[model samples]
Target chain A: MARKLASEDLTPVAGGGLLHRRLFLKAGLVLATAQTATSLRAEEVAATTPRAKPEDPADPSWIHKPGLPFTGYGTPSKYEKHVVRNIGGNRTPQGDGVSWTPLEELEGIVTPSGLHFERHHDGVPDIDPAVHRLVIHGLVQRPLEFTVANLLRYPMRSRFLFIECGGNSNAGWHEEPIQRPAGSFHGLVSCSEWTGVPLSLLLDEAGVDPKASWVIAEGADAGLLNVSLPLSKLMDDAMVGLYQNGERVRPENGYPLRLIVPGWEGITNVKWLRRLHVTDAPAMTRNETAKYTELLPSGKARMFTFVMDAKSLITSPSPGQKMHGANVYEIRGLAWSGRGKISKVEVSADGGKSWAEAELQDPVMSQCFTRFRSPWAWDGKAALLKSRATDETGYVQPERDVLIKERGREGYFHYNAIVCWAVDEDGTISHVYA
Target chain B: MSMLRCVAALMIAVSVASLAVAEEDTRVKGHIDGAHGSAAVEPAASANMRLGTPLTSDDIAKWDRTIFPDGRGLPPGRGSAKEGRVIYEQKCARCHGEHGEGGTSEELVSGPTPPSPDNPSKAIGSYWPYATTIFDFVRRSMPPAAPGSLSADETYAVTAYLLAANAIIPESAEMNAETLAAVRMPNRDGFIWIDVKK
Candidate 1:
């Protein structure tokens, strides 16, 4: 049996609508609602059940003894051990696989460095920064080689961006709805504050030749993973990421150095970056022509389709979560666009029949995750929920049918469609195509 | 009364001197270079900050293993499918299967079947656009356990074996840096680049 929630328990914000609680927006700044929700629930629990003090001359267990000494590094609490990445890999070859970030269990826009999603071709190579060198050659006036110390001296910039796998959310193309947690299906994307030096500064020093158009960025992994990127894009905003969040980048996420192509596909952001060879033509690597290319309905394969389209997913009220006989629940989700910042996200309670504007969290920068929330007053009835995003470029996320019609059914990558979660009268939530 | 007038004049002079000092302090605090006269002073041009070292041709050659579609960067080596069969049976058959049918890893050959929407088999023959990709991928990362361990001749042999098995090349075809690049893949013209306007 589900415990019923009271409508009066949730106090609406002043000057906001009755049903919607704009908890994210306060004085034009976005407040952290995950912290607020935790504190609010704690307060409600304390008010309902007050604990009596111990009667004897004995102190509480935690207070009776001194706490453990602080360490040089900290870890998540023991209670949060369940919040781990779900590893999905090949059986025979241990390294060739992916580990999905548990997006449903995470809060806020930034994905912790430890819990970030991973997609490796060969494996996570143990690279020593001392010997690692990034050589820039090919069509340049002067070919140069930079060590880890040399790259650190160049000017750098930081950005909050999302790196989504080209194959993220590909289960939507299935004939039947995938019966799994939302994160397991769509957690290939993760956001972080990456700091790095721009590739243009190095190109300027090298004196790029006039004929050079494409730059082949390669990694130092066992696979020697390489991808051809446009020189124009690299000069625009591409970075040689040295740090993730604040500290140095983790090994799995490309330690030593990485090529951070903001808003582009994840594969192009070559990890453990070792070399950049500028050329007038593309290398026509296996990944570019055979793998990442999309099989369109017109029988012509779409190659080098880099930019990730606008997509939004309601993390809560998604599959595997129950309504708990909801009275008033805050529906929260993440929206992002590779083209630019997300302008709006609309939540449809009745499955696209009607939609209401959700409040977008403040400081919504371009090519970053924008947290959105909307208050819903459930009457303990069966309902369907969905979310659609619109980017600053005026491109709206398409529905499943529309996407299938455009890309065809045989597509294996880049599936971004509106997802629907059906809430039954029994409070159980399930995936649906409605 | 004349003595008081002298003191007032002295006080006015002191006040004017302090105001001028304060103005000078403000200018200094603002980093205003008096020589430039504050008309958007440009940074002083200094010698180039040569951060990284210049690499010699030999140093560049060691790490530059990239193989372009036009046959550039292929090492000097030659092999045939006959020679590659022995190596494939011993080293690669465990993962890629006995006849390149694929067991644990990717399938290497698909025979005469073309890739379609319903039956998409991305193998060496059906999907790969360039033959140089086979040589490049095999040379760089093959036999996953011991990658980059294969000799240039061994890589060419394996590439020839895979191409021959897929019926794309003759069984006795000799594969080298130039010949491998000249081998036309079946789906070479199958791809079309579409630049979607954001």
Candidate 2:
């Protein structure tokens, strides 16, 4: 009586797919047939069973007790304590490394503020907002000094976007596949609703000099991290973000204020912003010249590569998770693009041999995380699962081999390729570069 | 009687036009009042509204510590590698190895060779594009324990020592704003702007 399910049968209708079953429940549709059947069965069971002891002390613990008092600030439930950022720092120096966002543990698009990924050069500086002042000088017609209060007075806009380190997912360039969870390997990117004043308005207030082309944005951290960004880009869509996720920005994520350049690399969105020096040329700072620059196969180093390309990753049933025997499971993952909105995400159960278009979650905004899902029926057979993303620019996420061929084997940053997870007959999953 | 009625009509029209002008003035006043009352309000003309205070030259100088590759912003100081060795032993050798071989922090000097596809060692001499970056970086952030604590002379000395140790410059060479800017790096032409092509 076993029969193979066709691809058409597996494909879900709009808003009526297996992935939207939870959404349907939230929509409040009653299951009349199941409810009536359950009621009749309950009637039969009540007639045969004895009356329960309602007044017994062991019946319930909180029956006659008052609940705990409310707290001013709330935290995640005790059961979710394990959901924390996976810290990966240098052995000698305490805070010289990076912490990854738990991407697999998160649901939907918005990554919580506390669990956002962190990348520190020296370490986080305890900056006082009152003492901190953002100075705009150099080639400007009139140099301006603004406090946090002055910045808050400007017209503000909120946007849901992702900030990804240029060095994120660099493990993919390794000779062999990394066996860690998806989050540990690729969680340097995080999404949030950032509220701030547009950089264009601030620049207009200062009146940028006609000759000024670049703006060197510097952070107030101990490292004095600085990088040069084109004034054209800052005037385009950059923001001086003051808040994150409906609250004041967290300490780890540039408390009080930060610069947010949508769809650009995270380093360009200088956290703990302190200065903006307009200039005719790039400063060619240490970060821009020495670090963050990639050496090409042609014996030339690629500099000022700011934009993060389109990428996707399948979170559930990834490495470190096991699949149950032969049932329909919802394959879920996240897709994002720096060029624009994610146009499509294709899931392939048999590696790259054939792919099916996955359903994208609602409110798929540009330069934001878009959740894509598909339902797959596993037959307890060995299979390879992979997801590839396509952005609005018609750029497809390349395969591991294709990416290696293009970028070369000496890659250290901006490693975005289709990730594959192999599912064995024993129901164990592991990373595979298919 | 007809002439009197026409005059009264003209008077009424004149009063209504004057009232309309008064109402327009009140609306403009209301806009100004709204902008003054709440900081959240968007003013009708942002060009007219002055928000931040204008910075003076001294105030700007305090935070403008950035140094360009052209040596335009280098502070006035001079030091030799010989003088730098003493300071290096006292302050830098603990974290950065005695010969800048690197212990806890990044190695300042490595083998006197450029990085290749096979053996990529991005040390100070082999990779950095500009010599002024050494002065800028050392002065801004060095001795991880206390950044921006080094004296101007100390920073220049350290820059000279690192440059000499990496075999980029002679040990006796004095480093200052002028000399450091003139010294061309080995990898000065190694970089290409990839964004320009895009």
lDDT of the candidates, in the order given:
0.82, 0.80
lDDT by residue for model 2 (B107-195), tens: 77865565677656567877788888888777777766687999888898988998899898898999999898898887788777866
- List RMSD in Å for every model shown: 11.5, 10.6
Worst 10 residues of 1 chain A by lDDT: A27-36
Each model's interface RMSD (Å)? 11.8, 10.1
TM for candidate 2 is: 0.84
Off by over 4 Å in 2: A1-64, B1-47, B111-113
**How far in Å is the alpha carbon of A319 misplaced in model 2?**
1.5
Docking class of 2: acceptable
- The residue-by-residue lDDT of candidate 2 on A1-434, one tens digit each, is 33454455544433212323243223332221111222335567778888765456776757779988889799997756767899985545565779999888788999999999999877888989999888899998789988887787565679999999999999999988998878899999999999987787778778899998999999898878889999999988999999999998887899778999999888998999989999988888888877888876655677888889999999887776667666667788999999899999988888877777788899899999999877665666888888899999999999989988787766477889999999888777889888
Cα lDDT of model 1 by residue, A1-434, tens digit: 23343445344432122144353233232212222222335567768885686335465578777899978799998756767898975556778888888877777899999998999988999999989999999999989999887686555679999999998988898899988777888999999999987788788778899999999999999889999888999988999999999999999999999999989999999999999999888888878876888877655677888899999998886666666664656778999999999999988878787777888888798999999888776667788888899999999999999999999976677888999988788777788998
With a 3 Å backbone cut-off (N, CA, C), the pairs that clash in candidate 1 are none
